[model samples]
Target chain A: MIMTVTLTILCLLLILCFVTTSIIPTPVGACASLIGGFLLLSFIYGFLGAHFAAVIQIIVYAGAIMVVFVFVVMLLNVPTQDLPKVKISLADILSILLSIPVLILVSIKILNWQAPMIDSQNVEMKDIARKMFIDYLWPFELISFLLLTALVAAITVAHKNKGSRYMLKEGSDHGR
Target chain B: MTIIFSIIVFAMVLIVGFHVAPLMTWVERRQCAFIQRRVGPNRVGIFGFTLFGLGQPIADAVKLLFKEDGNPSYVQPFFYFIAPLIPSVTGLAALMVIPFGAQDTFFGTVFSPQVLSVGAGFLLFFAMSSMSVYGVTLAGWSSNNKYSLLGGLRASAQMISYELGMGLSLIPIVLIYQTLDLQQIVYAQSHSYLFGFLPDWGIFRAPVSFFIFLITIFAETNRLPFDLAEGEAELIAGFLVEYGGMRWSLFFLGEYAMMFAFSGLISCLFLGGYSLPYLTHESLIHIVQPILGSFGSIAVFLIEFATLIVKMSIIMLIFVQVRFTVPRFRYDQLMKLGWVTILPLALINLFVTALVLGYSSFK
Candidate 1:
């Protein structure tokens, strides 16, 4: 009963932090809030016996992805004066409208769901790795391929302007 | 009872984490001085009585505490204020999973030297250490200075790049141990012997991974040779250009705390952790039992704890020595080292380790 209450409170607090991230004016503030939400969600996941998922959530989202986001924000050096003002447009309304049904569906599912008895055996890393390789092998391989393609695409786009210098040299050679 | 145990563990952590910076400052300075043939911090305390200017860290702490807390008018106040705290918090948090000594049972209560013995122990450490990038990045961005911005950018990029190598290097250890629990890893190391003489430490088993991990950690901690984040010559202390007094001291504390944590981690993973050569916990207990009687277990714990601390101090000394010995790598060179060299080397080491382990098992 105590665990249930604590988990509920944690979930509520996580939602509050998540909402605050959207509402925050400063990019740093929003990012920090998002990090907090990620940590809290990881805690919730850990409590639900998804230990590997919890660690991955923190490692991928809070650690790697957020660090990159912060890096980009710092690099761009976007002045506070240049920050885009938030406005409740049709898109915002549409997003809220779209999210409401999903929220309701999730809430209904959560309400009906019974909490499993706390198990002594924690989820191990090998189990996750085995499942990923055996059951989700195709999807995992496909995702890696997709990531590789995206990386190549990004490099190609970055190199395009630099390629003009080589093109100029080739053009002179052709004229000669 | 559990709450009381947690409080005790936290207290120990705080005491160690908070003091590491000041202690390391003295160690670094004295070590650097020895390298350069100069006297260092000898005037602060008694010459011979103070353990060769050991009191220097205390004096430095006092000076830092009383110094002016300077804040520029143009800087972003909130981010600037919170930035330094992030590194210290994360650095300290990473310590929670690291086992300092063997688990002990005393008076019907079980005590593990570490604060949190989670299933994903080292992974959690990685997660916390990665979060430290925010502190550097935010400090630079909020300072409203070009040098600070550059410093932050270098730090984020350096940390991100090296982290891949660091993570990859540990894959072999995980594969060998077949567990992520640090205590289990340490226990595993204690039991195994290489050729009946040397301890089967991770260093011996995966020397390449150890080297890669050591180098990556130097980059991760922003120490010399990889400390482009705070390159004094080029960027005027890098992301720390605008910071002064206690705020600056917080960053200093965080850096050393990270150094301490990483050293502990290196000792834990590569070294035999709390175990000495041929001095397993059971052996220690056996050795002490005749003399100490009922206090044998307690004595063994103390000895193991001291052994770990000694190992950690040795690693810390190496960190200081390397800081003085190695010249700072150029920015391109640093990136190339991490991505081009270390990453591929770590991957190869992983593959080699897997092959060796598989072949040996089959044989």
Candidate 2:
């Protein structure tokens, strides 16, 4: 009962933060909301017995990825004057018009949905690890290697001064 | 023993962790002064007889409390307000997972001395520490200063880059221990002997990883050598230029606190945390149980806690001394070290560790 109440409050707060982020549309504020949303979601995950998942969510998405987002946003240094004016797109109107029945249907489904009891105390993190590492090992390694290659490629592309005198020469220490 | 008792224990641990911040301020200043051949903070004390300036932190606290905290109109109110709290909160929250004592039974219930002994363990600490980047980034962006924003971005980028190497370095330790639980790792270290002689601490097992982790932590905490973002000469205190009084000091407090937490973690992982060499908990209990009777385990717990604190302090001392000993890294040099040097070194080390482990297991 207590867990339910706490999760309810947290979820509500997350929605509130998302709303605030949308309303403000300030880049830094939006970034902060993004982080805040991650934290709340992590907490909700923790309550739902996905402890490792919760921590990884924070570490990878909120901590690592959002940091890059914030970095780009900061680098861009967009002034408030340049912020996109709020406009009610026809697509938005159509989406809202299309969402009423879907929302009601989803609500009905959720109303009847039975959440599995998450015995946080008993959930075995080892199970998740074994599934990922032992069972799905190749896919995991492939994804990781793919990401690493992508990172290298991105860095290569981002070398702003490719042929400058200060260019870190290939196959050298850059005269360290 | 019970939920209520556990909460009380957690509060006690938290209080102790909080004290580390102010205490570190004193330690850093005194160490810096000694290194530079100057007397540091010897004035503030009872009856004007300075007790090696032990009262300095108290005085500094009082001054900060009284100092006018400016709320500049130029800065964004919400982000600026929220930013300072993140580092300290995250630092202290991360500290909660580290076990300081034994999982001894005392009233038919087993109790280990940590605020939370989650399975994620030190990974959770990394999670919290990673979020600390937001504090710097938000502080810079919110302060409405270009220099601050640049500093914040650079510092956070350094932090993120170093984080990859740091995570890679720890894989060897996890492989050796076969557990992510910090308590189990600490226990394993206490008992596992390397070559039937040396205590199986990470230092002996994975020296390369240890060195890599140490360097990354310095970068992570934004300390000297990796502290080009906070370089005084160029950007003039960088992101911190706009912050003042308690607000400014909170960031410092958070840094020091994280430094303290990291020191404890390093000690726990690399040194036999809370367990003295040749004096495992079992041995201690056996030796003291008869003499002290039922209180022996409790006594041992206290001793272990003290031992952990001592180890943590030693690491903190190293953290302080390094600040004065090392010169600052240039921005490009820092990046090269993190990516070109440390990342490759970490990957190679991990490969070597895996090979060695596999070979030994086969034997």
Best by DockQ: 2
**lDDT tens digits, residue span A1-176, model 2:** 78667877888898887777777777877877878888898988888878888999999999999999989878877677776799999999999899999989988986775446776666666788888899999999999999999999998888867566555355434111
The residue pairs in collision within model 2 are none
Q: What is the interface RMSD of each candidate, in Å?
A: 1.5, 1.4
Model 2 Cα interface RMS deviation (Å): 1.4
TM-score of chain B of 2: 0.97
Q: What is the C-alpha lDDT profile of model 1 across B1-363, one tens digit per residue?
A: 666766887788879888889888888888889999999876667555777878788888889889988879999898899999999998888877778778876556777778977666688898889888889999998898899989999999998899999999999998888788888888778865756787878888788889999999899999998999999999989999999899998998888888889988888888989888766777777788899887777788788878888998999999999999999999999999998999999999899989999999999
Model 2 spans > 4 angstroms off: A137-176, B107-109
Model 1 is docked with a DockQ of 0.56
> Per the 3 Å backbone cut-off, how many clashing residue pairs does candidate 2 have?
0
Query: Which tens-of-lDDT digit does each residue in B172-212 have in candidate 2?
Result: 99998888888888888887575668887888888998899
lDDT of 2: 0.84
